[model samples]
Target chain A: MTKKVATREAYGRALAELGKKNSAVVVLDADLSKSTKTADFAKVFPDRFFNMGVAEQNLMGTAAGLAAAGKIAFASTFAVFAAGRAFDQIRNSVAYNRLNVKIAATHAGITVGEDGGSHQAIEDIALMRSLPNMTVFVPADEAETAGAVEAAAQMNGPVYIRLGRAGVPPIHGEGFRFETGKAVVVREGRDAAVIATGIMVTVALEAAVTLAKEGIEVRIISMHTIKPLDVKTIVSAARETGALVTAEEHSVIGGLGGAVSEAVCENHPVPLKRLGIQDEFGESGKPDELLVKFGLTAAAIAGAVREVVKRKG
Target chain B: MENSEKELAVLKAAANEIRQDIIRMLGTAGSGHPGGSLSAADIVTALYFKFLRIDPENPKNPDRDRFILSKGHAAPVLYSALAQRGYFKREELLTLRKLGSRLQGHPDMKKLPGVDMSTGSLGQGLSAANGMALAGRLDSKDYRVYVLLGDGETQEGQVWEAAMASAHYRLDNLTAFLDHNRLQIDGPIEEVMSPEPLADKWRAFGWDVQVIDGHDMNQILQAVERALTVKGKPQMIVAETVKGKGVSFMENQAGWHGSTPNQEQTEKALAELLANKL
Candidate 1:
């Protein structure tokens, strides 16, 4: 079995390390410290951790306040609550002021498992990406989560880091560095490209492997930063591959798929297909089963790639 | 006793100037909220002139006290306060709500100095104040955080949420004022949505609550003094005020909530404020 780690776990570990390095770092959680994995940081730096009960609005607002006072504040909660419940605070207090606040939201997308539609934040990407001065991130695995967390701490404005509850296999080897606003090309190919984010990046990789046997030679690009989309890399991939498929564990409306769609249409028009939730909510089920049910598995991405490739020429 | 006459005289002068600035800014902008601005003038003037430990020369001094006008539509009052305190030139007050002006429709801390936070949407200031208070405790810094809120703004659920958190964290360094003008954009707060039993509500929410005349400089100073001695809990001073307190025709009228004063109305308001000067 492949070794796996939840992105949220990496975030917790990275945050603890960061707290040790930067005294200005402070963490606030809205009663989900255990699940969001911020408890790890709290255990190490109890004085800097604030548990604001179950109030997400206060959580973000308080985080903005700390940032205003020159502290790097990380406010964590489920994506639904962070992007939904406290959107006004995030928009006005954090984003409008461009405060140094990191909204490290976990349990994003349909893979929140048994939480059902109400808890699953299928629209979080659209909600956050729509805001001005908000840097949205859907980090795929441990390395990306850690890098994104560190980057958000250093950046001078509001950032939204979307982490997954389900464990994902490591995507990069040792010494892998994460750069802001840059897409990582996991594999190179000529026939088509699969641009993916979050858990869907792993699925896209698997899909590329299967397509390789089928002689499709699909390329895979892990787009970690949803906002400030790497248009250069995306346009280059579109020109080289001539066909593209976007896969995400979120709604295709405003997630990675939507972002890639806009980029490709504006700059380099290519045969493109979006593979993710079909404008619907998620139901209670195992993470894997939900992925398969929502057509977010390797086979679905593979199918999307094949369809896009056929449209080429 | 109350504040000394000489000290009150200085605050009264500053407040009278802010009220006049509010009238002039509103008259120049052709659109702004003077009702709440005039209502909050004395409290803000006292903070800017007497109480707040802030330096006009170095606005970003790390150790200086912080103040947030949480009820941000009253930006004229804050801008006037900042200008009068030399955070910016007093001439900039006339450019409020104009093109490319730092005096935005609401307070923008990023653009203007001495503004502790940017707040426009209601009910968010207390939480940000809580965060600053929390940061102060974390860093073992002695800087205090003060915020002013509108009475109608407390109708927002987040104010109550922040109140609970402030008490839970025992933020003695944080102080809040509710500008209980009892009027909002729609109508009287009681007729629209009553955040009634305001004192009881705050006390029940674990705050050291005080009710005072918001327009009285002496009362405002006294309230500030008592709130400092509060231990291990935040304080809320419920300030009862008229919507447009100083101007004769504008006082207690809901119609002035967001309306601009005409040139004649501006002259009249200015004369009244100038004559009322101590």
Candidate 2:
């Protein structure tokens, strides 16, 4: 059995580990340190951690400022607050300036569970990906989260790392290598491809297995970085597979699906189907129940894969 | 250090030149903010000339003091100051708001050499300034960070959020100036949205507040000197200024907030500024 670990937990641990090695590392949070998991970094490096109350704009602005003074700054908060409340600050102060600020946001997508629509950042991927100088990362598992966080720290520009609340099955082993703008191929096949990001990667892997039992061999591609997209990999997948299905724990509009579609249409046109929240707000429900209600299960991904394969004819 | 008699004259002359740049740039660009840029000319002049420890040759020197124009609509003031300080050629001032020009409508730190931060959207500069101050603390750098905010720009909620963070972090290395010009794009700041009791608001947010005449070069220099002694809190200099300074017709006129001077008006404004006996 695969051990389950939430990407947010791995993010916090990675930050704590990073602080010891890099003296320039500083963390700022909008009073959600515990939830965002920057508390781990704060506990270890009290002098470098800043709690900017509940002000998300200031949290981003402060990170930009710190980056300006030659420090690698990480600003953390929930996805909704970080992307929605502080959108302008992130756009103008961080991305426009191309500062070395890492926006490590947690509680993305519907998996945020009980807090309801107000808390779920269903459109964060879209919001972050739209910025010009922003490098967007949606790590699928704990390993990817750690890799993305460390990679984000090493870079000298604005980055947005989307982390999740619920634990998912591990997709990578100890030897998993994280490369920016490079998609990792999990399970290769000949029939069609499944492009997934965030929590949807695990679900797509499960769906690929189920499709295999039905005599359909589907390729599973884990698209970790949403922006600076791996266009080469996506074009190759489309050309080789002849069809593709995109999955993400986010709105179908402007999420992984939209990004993939844009790439495929311009480079290699393939029949594609998107499986996601479908331009709608999520509500109060257990994460499991919400996944089922929103049709975000392995079965849904499998259905979309079959439909896209059929359209390839 | 007290400003000697000769030093004041140089600052005054520089400020007068910056005001002329503002009028010339706006007139050349055909459309740009002149009022706030003219209002904060003296303050920007003081920071660039007397207060800030900056270098024109190597503007990106890591240890150099940082200045962020929070009220980015007043880019002309900052551009003029940077040009006069020889960050770039003064002839580049005419390229304001022009396509393919380094001088963008708002400050673009990437394209411009001396810009510490890119600011155009309101209420974001103070937060970036606070971050720099925090970074200085983390890196043990003694370089101070300064930000200039417009009075009307305070209406942005992010400014207050930044205000709270500035105090919470105890950033003594940061100093913010409120260019309280009283006029915004729409009309009077009070009529549009009263940011009245502005001094109390800054003090309440934990800044050591000081009120001053923004155009007075001596007062501008003194306020910054006083800010250096502040130990734990950020300093907020509430500068009382006219919407437009120097030009007789434009001074205190709300209509001049964003309007550019016509060729005739530009010549007249320049002539009046040139006739100053300061």
Candidate 3:
């Protein structure tokens, strides 16, 4: 069994390490420091951590202000609140002004579990990606989350990193480098390509293994950066492989599926099937149950791959 | 330290000129919120020419005091003050709200120099100001942050959230001025959505509260002086001002909240402002 770690835990540890290296880095949370894992940084750097109460709007605005004053502010909150509630503040104060504020929103997608539909931010990717001057990242595992956090700190603009509540298996081995706006092809095959992000990357790998048993070779690509997407990797995947399957833990409308389709349709049209929540809201359930019910399991990706491959023929 | 009579006369003249410029800019744009702009003229004037330690040449100086117009519809006043302070050429003031103009309808910090924070949305500036204040403390900088909010803007819940954080964090370097003109766009602030007992609200929020006449330059300057002496808490100055002050027809009238005067009314308004010059 592979070791598992939640992306938010990786984010908290990465932030604390980053704070030790860069004194200019400051952390702010909307009274969810304990949950958002910003409390880790607060413990290390008591003077640099700011809990802005329960006001998401104030949290975002304050982060922008801190960024303007030569500080790299990492603001944490639930994805629903950070991307949905305080969107205007992020758009106007942070993105419009091009401030150096990183919004590390956690508990994204249906995996938030039991908290119900209101807590699940199925459209956070769409919201952050639509904003100009915002770099949207959805890391697949703990290693990628840590790398993305460091990369976001080095960059001088607004970044939104979506983190999950559920633990995910580490796919990368020793010395796996991460770069912004670049996609990593984990498994290479020619029969078909499965493009995935976040926890779905692990699912795609499992689906590839299951498909190999049936004499079907499938490729898997982990598209971590959603905005400034590695169009070259996606286009090549569509060109080399005749069929494609896109998967995510978000809505099929405007998340990874929408982004991939828009890129593929414009560059190279192929027999593509997007496997995600079918434009529906998530309900209260266990994380694994919700994943299975929402058709986000490895079996679902394999099924989509089979359908797309059949269409390719 | 009180301002000498000569300095007070100069500040009064500057405030009157800023009011005149606000009228000219709004009249040229043919539309804008003149009531709030004119009401905040003296406060803006005192900050720009008297209180704030800012250099127009080095607008982005690290240690310079920061000012945010939380009541951003009053861009004319901030623009006029910036122009008069040599942040930009005075001729550019006439191009306000025009096509491709840096002086936008609201304060855009990215577009214009000397704007510390981009604020058009009400109830958000106080938080940004608080952030700057926090950063100042963390860096051990003595730079103060000032924010101006409209009385009607206090109705937003985020304002109070920022208020709570400002005090909770013990930000002694931050000062907020509430442009208590008592009039909003719809009607009187009391009828629209009263944020009355305003002083008590700030006091309860753990700020050093001071209530002064908004249009009084001497009182405005003195309150700032006293606020600077305060330590370990944020300061709030509740300024009592008449909406559309200096123009007889517009004073205390909600109808002039966002309406621009026509060419004839412009001349009449400018004449009234110039006639009352100190």
Query: Pick by DockQ: which candidate is best?
Result: 2
lDDT of 3 at A305: 93
Ranking by DockQ: 2, 1, 3
Chain A TM-score vs. truth, each candidate: 0.99, 0.99, 0.99
lDDT of 3 by residue, A230-312 (tens): 99999999999989999999998888999999999999999999988898899999999999999999999999999999999
Clashing residue pairs in candidate 1 (N, C-alpha, C atoms within 3 angstroms): none
For model 2, residues B116-235, the per-residue Cα lDDT tens digits are 999999989998898888877777889999999999999999899999888987999999999999999899999999988999999999999999999888999999999999999999
Candidate 2's error at B254, in angstroms?
1.1
Q: lDDT of each model, Cα atoms only?
A: 0.92, 0.93, 0.94
Tens digits of per-residue lDDT, candidate 1, A1-313, equal 6789999999999999999999999999999999999999999999999999999999999999999988999999999999999999999999999999999999998889997889999989999999999999889999999999989988889999999999999998898899999999988998999999998889889888899998999889999999889999999999999999999999889888899999999999999999888898889999888998999999988888888888886
Find the 10 residues in a row with the least total lDDT in model 1 chain B.
B80-89
Q: Candidate 2 or 3, higher DockQ?
A: 2
Q: What is candidate 3's DockQ?
A: 0.83
> Which order, best to worst by lDDT?
3, 2, 1
Per model, the share of native interface contacts recovered reads 0.86, 1.00, 0.83
| TM-score of each model's chain B | 0.98, 0.98, 0.99
Lowest-lDDT window of 10 residues in candidate 3 chain B?
B1-10
